[model samples]
Target: MNEITVSLPDGSKRSLAAGATILDLAASIGTGLAKAAIAGKVDGNLVDLQTPLADGATVEIVTEKSPDALHIIRHSTSHLMAQAVKQLFPQAKVTIGPAIETGFYYDFDLEKSFSPEDLEKIEAKMRELAKADLKIEREVLSSADAIELFRTMGEDYKVELIQDLGAESVSLYRQGDFVDLCRGPHLPRTSLCKAFKLTSLAGAYWRGDEKRAMLQRVYGTAFADKKELEAYLARIEEAKKRDHRKLGRELDLFSFNDEVGAGLVIWHPKGAMLRTILEDFERREHLKRGYDIVLGPQILKTELWQRSGHYENYRENMYFTTIDEQGYGIKPMNCLSHMMIYKSQLRSYRDLPLRFFELGTVHRHERAGVLHGLLRVRGFTQDDAHILCTPDQLDAEIKGVLSFVRDVMGIFGFDYEMELSTRPEKSIGSDEDWERATSALLSALKDSGREFEINEGDGAFYGPKIDIKLRDALDRRWQCATIQCDFTLPERFELTYVDADGEKKRPVMVHRVILGAIERFIGVLIEHFAGNFPTWLAPVQATIVTVTDNQIPYAETAFNTLRAAGVRVQKDFRNEKLGFKIREAQLQKIPYMLVVGDKEVEAGLVAPRFRDGKNLESMTPEQFIAFIQDEVKSYR
Candidate 1:
């Protein structure tokens, strides 16, 4: 046999017999490496260990410790799950399964819905298959042959998918009697799929189209080891306990009614108060940052949306109506009105950077299936702002917004990541404008010295943007802030300012939101804090619990004094026992409870007890009011 030379990741070369596979190369290095090898990377592309290494090809042996290991393991585990499902329910047909960010999911079309008991059986079967350690092999066949093979197996979905692929050849992976159509690079054997668990089941439309057949989606996750899997499961349990919807109901914050409609939030008193506090904070922050408070009409002429490219690019998400023979669009974005405001005035270069801020309420037609409690609602308010600045000033404006995001996230004790999304295929604007806008955002992000990833082809239709995703207590990412740079929209609306040379020049617009949506942020906060809001943010900061009927008069006096002094205080004077009232208040997550008894009345003081069972020293009403004020100011 002829000798072949292959390049290792460390830039070293190894001579082996021609047609040597990646597994053979691993063995050549060391026996331990061969045993640890689960897959291989050939010239940066993941491949099976059986893949032949071409002469002089760059290769890296993938072990369980590699970053790509989990994805490959999860993908293979999905196949393991599919094989189990097929063995248990031969009537069920498989469609597609792919590894997602958190885990993997496989979709199945069956006449019966999957129950929890069925999941257990399927999982048990998967364990059995894994224990058998069946050798998994990949095979390529002509598209026509692939379709015929799936058709014989009664997999209509697979056949349809293969036909739609319109390819000359297709690859399929087979383990035992079970086979699935997929791209290359899976585990060599079934037993490698050890640390896996089927998390949940959901109903998903085939290909995400509501008109198509609904399929059962089995969600599962796989880790490199059992310890990591256990940790993930523990986090998931904690997440369930901290779910915002459950906390909302328990804390009497918000609700959604069928009578009102889907994706619309009905805020209760406490929820409304929380929202108001957040909005007030946004206003003060914006004002301090030199933003001019502004408001726009809820509905605008549809022609304006068309002129702004929204009607052409985003019409599906917009609501339209005819008012007095004039077509109108309920504003789904606040950019158009801000543009109108810019064009409303004649300006010089001195007035170049006009920052207009609005706590704008907008409506979008969100699909019912995607809407969650308050996170993905149709009707919501945004802390939206637009900064119209000269081209030279664009970088500063964007960095300012980045600084604003950093400060706000720090205040909330949240760690966040940023992604720079570039132009999408369906976006509007000239290539030159798109490049300029993308470059501006990129420059600002780089100058800020913060690491960010480039998310390709996910930008808004008009321009590129920086998306800020904040990590919560469970390390889950939520889309909270965004900064979008647009050179096209100002040109579309013909917004111009006089330059130093007295020539009218088009100004660039930076549309940004520090906290993307008020409702979503509040939901994130509820989950982040687990409904135990800090003293400053608690809707009812303090409550007065009278020791007995004799103390009601004193409790009422204390409550009125606190209320007058600007404390969010409530009184529990229903003639209840002190401990009972204290327990109820604690359940409500009130920050402080002031107990009024005969002794308290005599001393003209209140016994303050913290929700965590710590007792503050007795203080007069005036002194307590000052303490609360000081605590609130500390958050600021």
Candidate 2:
């Protein structure tokens, strides 16, 4: 037989028959590897184990332990799910199904909406199909033939997709009696998708267009083994318990009303207090870091947005209104006004770095379907700031923002990851400007000594950015802080500074936010702490509970004293039993509960009980106030 040489990932070469498959290569290496291999990567592209190996190509075996294994498993499981759904409901038409970061989902064009019972049945069928160990084969066909095949199968959505591709040929994957249009690099057998579960179902618009037909989306997840699947399910359960919307009502923090409109948050008293505390912290931090607090109008002339490229690139997310026969666009961002501030005066290199901070409230036209509780709300306030600096000062300014993000996230006990996002296809500015902006951000990220990922083509419309995603207690990542380096915006707005050499130069703008949207951050905080906010952050630090009505006077005195001393204290002198009051306070997640009884009133002291059922030594109200202050200072 003719011989061919192929390179392994470890840079070793092996000679095999000319038409050798990846499976052949694996078996040539070892029986152990051949048994473990589920897929392979040939020259950096994933392929099935049976794919023909090209001479001189580098190959890496993908086992269950490989990083790529889960994605392939999840994607194959999605097909498995579709096959099961089709078998159960013969008339169901399959749409797109792809693996997401968390799991996979497939949309079905069926008149009957799937119920919980249906999901159970579909999952059972999937397990049976996996046990059957059906062979999964990939085939190529001309576009015309593929369309006819799908049309014959009554999968109109697949037909439309093929037509949209306008390709000469397409790939399809088949297992048992089920065949579907896909770009195949899937599991070779159904049995490999054993550790899978159908999670939930939801309604989705076909191709995400509201005008299109609504389809039923069945969501699911797959793992390499049952143990990993169990762990993920446990986390999902914990996430449900920490769900902010549920805790928001239970803790009396925030709410939304359909009458008021979707994606709008109405902060109750406690919620408002929480926001006030965070906003106050932001102001103090900014002031300490040499940022000047600034404010801008809520709406600007529509021409300004057009000049900033928001009209062309971001108009869909913005709201516009005509005021007194003049068109105005509600601000979706705070940078435009900050840029105008820099333009208001001729700056010199002596004042090269000017940081303008604002706790600005902005509005966006979020679609109703994507409107999440507080995270994806239309109206929210951002701890936004813009730093304009000379080209020489750009590096330090970027690092300063990085340090700021580190300090703030550390204070909140959030472990975060950073991503350097490059320019997108719809972005503005010359290639040189985008390159410079991206380079500056990348340089600072490297100097920070922290690992980050490259997120290509996800930058802002004007420039590149460093996006910070904070991981919460349950290991879920939340998008919070961002540092955007924009040379284009300053150039467009004509922002300039006098160079040391007596020449006019445009200063680079670094737009950033530490906490991002206050509403969203609070929601994250709620879940992170599980409503058990630390002493400093709790809206009510302590509630004064009386054992009897006779101790009301003492409880009232303690509350007044604590309030006067800057403690967020509440009085719970209701005629309820002492245990009941304590239980209620504990349910509220208060950090401290001061128990006032006749014995304590006689001694002019109160007992402090922590919400976790720990008791502090009995002390006078003044002493407790000092202790609370010490605790707050400790956090700082």
TM-scores for the candidates? 0.99, 0.99
In model 1, what is the error at residue 463, expressed in angstroms? 0.4
Cα shift from native, residue 511, model 1 (Å): 0.7
Task: Show where candidate 2 strays beyond 4 Å.
Answer: none
Q: Residue 24 of model 1: what lDDT?
A: 100
lDDT of 2 by residue, 517-586 (tens): 9999999999999999989999999999998899887788888999999999888878898899899999
Instruction: Count the clashes in each prediction.
Output: 0, 0
Error at 424, model 2, angstroms: 0.3
Task: Report every candidate's CA lDDT.
Answer: 0.93, 0.93
Worst 10 residues of 2 by lDDT: 1-10
